[model samples]
Target: MKVTLERNHLLKSLGHVHRVVERRNTYPILANVLMSATGDGLDLRATDLDIEVTETVPAMTATPGTTTVPAHTLYEIVRKLSDGADVVLETDGNDQMLISSGRSRFHLACLNPDGFPDLKSGAFTHTFAIKVQTLKDLIERTQFAISNEETRYYLNGIFVHTVDGPDGVVMRAVATDGHRLARVEAEAPQGSAGMPGIIIPRKTVAEVLKLLDGVEDEVKVELSDTKIRFTLGGVILLSKLIEGSFPDYERVTPKNNDKALVVDRDSLARAVDRVSTIASERGGKAVKLALTPGQLELSVTNPDHGTANEELAVEFDLEGFEIGFNARYLLEIIAQIRTENATFMFNDAGSPTLVREDGETKALFVLMPMRV
Candidate 1:
């Protein structure tokens, strides 16, 4: 088999498919990308058992055939080649693939494409289309809270479902890691109502985000009980869903936290970052926030690294309270707020604190307090 394609087009297609291939794999085929050249174009596919990505790029096909070669190696080779150079690919019956561009040539061992595994996508129960930017917003607002702990496998992904909202039905994404929780909602898209609540694995969510960048077109999503598929432009991604049940996240969201404190989002985030600088590694990175009627004091103390203190005038008129929080978690949650003011609703120093953008109900964050 022989195919000739522009170097830029080959590099772009390889970039899209090679990321799914792990650097090390137990199976040789899993480490390689399956390339099928037809009269129309060249198809590239790569998988790591759980997730698969495929794309087709236009090329001049002299002979039609299929083979598999190392995904990363092919990407690197094309990436280093001179721009605007034409690339030529050929496969021989001796299980060898040749890559040539400009004056450079590479010989890559080829695996029979017949042995490549296909992620069987059975009949899908639900299908929907959503704007790329809207879908990106839903993932970015909550993905940071996904758990990494292996024991509670359910919390390792974003829980996506449709729920009733004040105005109407809205699609919601919730993620929690026990210490912090993020919940964000958007207007439900057509054909999304009554859809199954599925947990998208962390890796798939990350890949979706990367693929969505700078995309102006809509994304087509198809899903079943066990699998999910996403199609954008010429690229397709399919992955297995997490099978465990996500906990009832609504129960953990604080409902009656009435002590309201509004502070400049930028100022609070900077203050938390500054004070935490002196926090020792042995002692957890905790910053104490002491709120008064009109002022807020942020302080951090470490026996090994001394102490830090800062004050900011805030819009707090309720009863004063002191709360401790993980510095890293606080900054992450604050960064999600798009408004100028970040409103914190606190029940007490021990209970979880609810935070949101001023006058915004679409996004909310809950943070557990730490003892300082």
Candidate 2:
């Protein structure tokens, strides 16, 4: 294979595909990226068994052929090259690939392209197109709540499905880590009415977000029972779905919490953060929220570090009640609120608390209280 491309184009294409390659791999071919040079362009593909990404870069092709080389090595070499330099790639019959740019040159061992594995995307049952901003919103709002525990494999991803919403059909994303839950929705795209629920793995979610960053174009989605494919311009990402079923998150959403407490989102977050400074990290950084008619007191106590306290004015309908929660969790939820004020609906000190933007219902959060 022989191809010559601009350094910037090569670096951008390599940046997109090299991330799929793991630093450590049991199989030799899995550690390399497959490069195919044709009259159309130069195609680069990399995979780590579970996920695969491919991108095409425009280049001057002298000899059309295919070969495989270390993904990260090539990416790093190209990244260090001077800007605007022309990069040349050539393969000899001796099973080696040569990379040259100005005064720099590297000869990397190559593997047979025939050995590269392919993740076959079977016939897709559903195909839909979603606005870039809408998809980005759904993911950013709920991705932080995805569980990292390996035992509950089903909770390691975001649950996505379409349902009949108040204003019509809407697509919703839900994620929970047992301690906290986030749910957000957007208007459903055309042809997504009866789509099956799917759990997109955390890694895939992250990759999709990167591809969507700063992009104004729409994303094309095609999915089957076990596989999902996302196409963004010249880049394609395919990932295997989690086979297990996600927990029934709707049942846990509290609906009867009546006591309303409204507080400035930024003010409450700062107060909680300040008071938790002396909180013991091993003790969950628990912050106590003592709500009175017109004021809220935030306090944290640690036997080893002493105590910290802060007060904030708040609007509460009920008399006196105190609740304990992880300060980190509280701040994370508050950061997602788009409005200036956040409303908390409390049932009791022991029950779960519901939080939302002052008057908006499109996004909601449920936080489990901790025992202080």
Candidate 3:
């Protein structure tokens, strides 16, 4: 195959697709990117066994054919070339690739394109179209809480499904790592009535978010029982759905906690960050929280090290209590809180505490209190 593609456009497409390729592979072709030159343009594709990404860019197709070349090596060569240079790629009879531009040249060992595992855009039974902003919001809101432990394979990705809520149909995304839980919901988009509740792998979620940055038009999505597909302008991504069942998250949310403590988000974040500096140097990453009549105090102490405490005036009522929590976790959840004031509801120091936006009911965070 022979083709001529603009250097920067090729680099951009490679940058987007190559992250999915594994560095060291048991299979030879999995390390390569599939380049297809048609009469109009060239298509670049890369995949691990679980996720696949494809991007099309304009190129002059001198000879129409398909071949596989090392994904990372090609990207590096093009990246180091002159800024506005054009890249010419051709394959020799012995399965080697020749890449040339200006004074630099490269010959990379090529693999048989037929050896790559099948990336089928299988017939999808359901398809829907939604605004790109809607999809981005859903991911950003709840992706932080996804579990990283490998034992509970089901909890590794966000649970995205439609459910019946008090108001009507709502689209929901939920994630939990056994210690903290984050749930977000919004009005369902136009044609997702019968869409299945699926667990999108964590890596796929990150990749999709990256792809959305360049696209302003609507995204067309298609899914089946085992796989899902996304189509944006001139690009497509396919991913395998996680196989296990997610735990029932509804039973975990607290029904009632009368103690309502409202604290400013920015102030709380700053205080927690400062106090945690002392606590983190010790162990357990635990910090103490005390809420009294007029002021709230954050303190952390380690017998071997030192201590830290900060006071802030907060809105609170009823009795006083003390609790401990992972300082980093609290800071992350607070960062996601967009409202001016965030409310914390606690039953006691030992039980799981509930956090919500000052007046919003649709999104809430549940955190298991830690012992310092």
Q: Write the per-residue lDDT of candidate 3 for residues 1-372, one digit (tens) a residue.
A: 789989999998998889899999988789999988899888899999899999888999998888899999888898899987999988865389899897878999988887877777677877888788878878887888999998998999988888888888888889999999998888877777668888999999999999999899689988887788989777789999898788999888888778899999999999999988867645778989998987899999977678999999999867788999998889878977879999999898988889888899778899999888
Runs of candidate 2 exceeding 4 Å displacement: none
Per-model TM-score on C-alpha atoms = 0.99, 0.99, 0.97
- CA lDDT, candidate 1, residue 231: 94
Question: Tens digits of per-residue lDDT for model 1 on 212-257?
Answer: 8736769999999899999977889999999989999889999999
lDDT score of residue 225 within candidate 1: 88
Q: Which ten residues in a row have the lowest lDDT in candidate 3?
A: 276-285
- Clashing residue pairs found in predicted model 3: none
Off by over 4 Å in 3: none
Better of 1 and 3 by lDDT: 1
Clashes of 2: 0
lDDT of 2 by residue, 183-242 (tens): 999999998888889999999999999988746769999988798999987899999999
